[model samples]
Target: MRIIQLFQVALVLMLLALSNEGRVNGERGDRQCEFNPSLSPRPHSVSILEFGAVGDGKTLNTIAFQNAIFYLKSFSDKGGAQLYVPPGTWLTESFNLTSHLTLFLEKGAVIIGSQ
Candidate 1:
């Protein structure tokens, strides 16, 4: 009798797990990930080049990135800002990211860490 009860409990747990196998958090069907570019549009936009960042992938752009964010910090009250990175490989050390600033990277643009 004890063996029969244990088997029944195991069967019930297995059925519960199988019922939710194809669902995510009780939601039916699969969901695709999506990114909407215009979800948070900034009123101000500035390019990294404006701050003297060379995208040759060799120049250490730590100062450039720092300066850019520092400059854009002023726009925090005016609907935020976007720091645009053009198509190239940018090398930089660690830098601080300010609030209300979006680091926009264009196609083919990449940022590499410097030693």
Candidate 2:
């Protein structure tokens, strides 16, 4: 009975250690593979805003979109801020992305525009 209990405990510990190590490895891989704004055409160090988003499927966040563009323009001179769009279907007339900007499109992202 003592040997069986010790073996069970050892098995659980081994499983926990392996699980932790695997989780760490997965995180490192994701971080390493993600897009970094530093490598964009121009790097920036500025702040942006996301305003007036409808947060629905029908309406496009015009003010929010424009705000993002304008904010990017503000930091264009200094260069190092990334404009991030949250995961959703964004309907906009147009979007002017800057060289220093980084656009991260998650899987199944949908951006609609009619011009």
Steric clashes per prediction: 0, 7
For residues 21-113, could you state the per-residue lDDT of candidate 1 as single tens digits? Answer: 878768986654466556577999999999999999888999999999999999999999999999999999999998999899988899999
Please estimate how well model 2 matches the true structure, expressed as its whole-model Cα lDDT.
0.62
Candidate 1 Cα RMSD (Å)? 6.2
lDDT of 2 by residue, 1-115 (tens): 9999999999999998877773564564334356545655446432222466543457866667777767776665676466655566777777667665666555545677755
Error of 1 at 82 (Å): 0.4
- Cα lDDT listed for each candidate: 0.92, 0.62
lDDT of 1: 0.92
- Residue 41, model 2, lDDT: 46
* Deviation in Å, model 2, residue 8 alpha carbon: 75
Q: Pairs clashing in candidate 1?
A: none
Best by TM-score: 1
